[model samples]
Target: MVQSQTHTFEGKTIDEAIEEAKRALNAEMDEIDIRVIDHGNQKRFPFGRSRAKIAVSLTESNDETWETWLDNEIEDQDLFDIPLSPDEKQPVNTAGTAWIIDGQLHFHQTAEKKPILVIPYDGEVYNHNEKLSGRHVLKENDVIDFHLETTLIETKWTVKVNDKEQTVTLTVTPGKKIIPYIADHPAASVIEPIVQFDEQVNNQLQTKDVYEQLANMEVIEGIDDAAIHRACSAGEEQTVTIASGKLPKDGKNGEMAFRIDIQERSLPYKEKHDGTADFRESLYIPSVEHGEVLAEVIDPLPGEDGISVFGDVLQAKDGKPVIIKAGSGIEIDEEQSAVIAAQSGRPLIEQSGLLFRMSILPKKRHPGDLSIKHGNIRFIGDVEITGDVNEGMTVEAEGNVQMQKNVMHSTIQSRQNILIHGNAIVSAITAGQNQAVYDALQDIVPISSPRTDLLSP
Candidate 1:
């Protein structure tokens, strides 16, 4: 006889625990037998903070059988699969036993310690000064006393399951107390339990009661019985959207429609290559040509009505209308659906009027480098500069910027690439694409570091 190795491990799930055991023991499926101690459950999604346990031990595959298999005499019948895992979660809730939680009352007794007490939520009892089983609500100045002692204790459970039945018993030591019906708790199947678990769970829900809360309740065909059964078995407290009143679905609001290809200029950060974060593409000035339709205001949609759970009719609010009429070089379409371009210019859409309006402005020009003479140029069209953009100058253009001289120590923004004949030095230049900008500064070295920030690069 050979002594077999044994070990126990825990994981977020049973499969995980088994895999951990396999890794620790370095054994194959045929070489080990796994006994699941506890099939743990999660309280919610993505991940629930709970654990499961499993026991693993080397199988009793004797030496003689192994020798026969090693001689190439093994057949497909030699392999087998084992299945002993829970299909879904089955929690054992402890909510019903408390009846009431986190409440206090005035005690008339002079004793220094008060016994742990639990009472029903709806039921009532007489409130006497000495009795702990009364129905009186507690408030401030309530007489209470207790000697605090913190002791760590282990919880134990014994589970027995069969094709038709599943039973769970919780045991507490030091006090030697055992409570059966772990599957019978009111909160057991908080999510959904399999139909096989129906016989095991206690405190099942009543569907008729839940249906009463919803107005114009429609019977969800096919899976209704199974869903309700599973929900009841799980003892879930979360509001069942299927069985509740449905609120109105508000209509889609009217919007100024535009294409993403034309509006993807202002980037949050520059993408990285090897290890550097390029910040070049922060400047986005949306521009439009003389004959281009920069924006179109779509029509508002009507809302859909909803029914309350209590059979009340809920009103649906309609989407508000927006007006895009005001602006030079831009005019409303014949159908009044869109704001069309009258002449070439950049459209400035804003919500200044009761609804919304867009204004189009003409081209801009900076005679010399940006200075106090220019005073922060913010143009909605193409821009041209005759001289270098000197220190502390800020220029923003909705269209392309054509610079004749080097840009230095300033903020230059453009929706399209800013074509510069001279070097770009010590300035934050934001543009749609930086590849052209990189090519423009291919040989230009920094005159001084000057804390320059090149965005949307």
Candidate 2:
């Protein structure tokens, strides 16, 4: 058994220490485990300075395995009975308050060192015989004289209007309730001792206060009373939608309607019970007869106007029109509002911005042989192959397919009739897109040589 080796290294930084360790041990980073011992501090000038230290230990031999190392290093512990510090250990920092209510003054202290409550400029308070001036702190059993204010802490609210003046939101800052003393007190008294008086937070806001604020802001069009009432009931610090503006609906753009069956031709493969689907079935090219309607042009619709909570008028949008023009092999019927095919050929559509250009190509002709270098051939119009169709090449046409030479190890299919004046050897060919004809053709023996008279069809 080879024993593990351990060493210590120090440098200005952790990366420098690891690099020094790696150079000294002549080992890569993954071959050993690194443990940081002390992260040294570097102070200004020469006052305090220390180097970073790391302990690099060689990993256990490959034979020991990770499970064995884990079993040797880790031990089970009793974690259920862990003890916690007592709550009395926590420090306390609390202050006291004082207030006056119901023609009487009171003061209460919560800690050893109580704060002195000073009389503000708006307060009408007096210290018995001599009227108190400036700041005055009342003590226990001290005599004080003051006028009886009817409502000490009244409900306060405010209204916020959006920048666009489209919405008005109401925010209510709840007031505190003046809790009168529980002890016996004389009514309309001249002097009362500062003994018992307290106050509690009152979250309930008044609706009348909100309405007065809204009226001041001139927001009366789309005010929601229920939302304001709910806000008043909840009373916490929150913003609610008191008024909302009606949003404008944009107009629908003009569209073109084409034949549904032609668009639905190219579909995804359907999975069979055997868990296999043929990709060729998903490929289809649609063809139209002469004078067949291709697309119907529809006009654009206009948009509606909207109104804001501030009674401002919002303008409506007018829908734009789509322009259409006919190219070769296509014609537009103005009376029927449709685009018709002029000849029995493939229909081609090209779109640029809002303009749609429709045309049709008569046929697609190949001057050379169909091979791997030329790739597969798929066209919407009839195909005319002048040369041979090579191995692994496929030809698919929407209309008729006419081959002049030989077809070897290839697939040729067409939606219409197929005329091949070539020798087909180990190749699949279908005429009129009939499944039964393709199946019967697959069973026929492959012809090796050119049999012009026997194979030509």
Candidate whose TM-score is highest: 2
For 320-414, candidate 1 gives per-residue lDDT tens digits of 67655566777666475655667644445555433555556555555766554435555546788888877766766656888889888888877
lDDT of 2 at 298: 78
Candidate number achieving the greatest lDDT relative to the actual structure: 2
RMSD of each: 36.1, 35.5
lDDT of 2 by residue, 213-332 (tens): 777776667789999998897645667889877656668767667652332134576575798864434533344556777778778889888777766667778777778778888888
Which pairs of residues collide in candidate 2? none
The superposed Cα distance between candidate 1 and the true structure at residue 176, in angstroms, equals 18
Q: 209 in model 2: Cα distance from truth in Å?
A: 5.2
User: Model-by-model lDDT, in order?
Assistant: 0.49, 0.64
Cα TM-score per model: 0.31, 0.46
Candidate 1 lDDT: 0.49
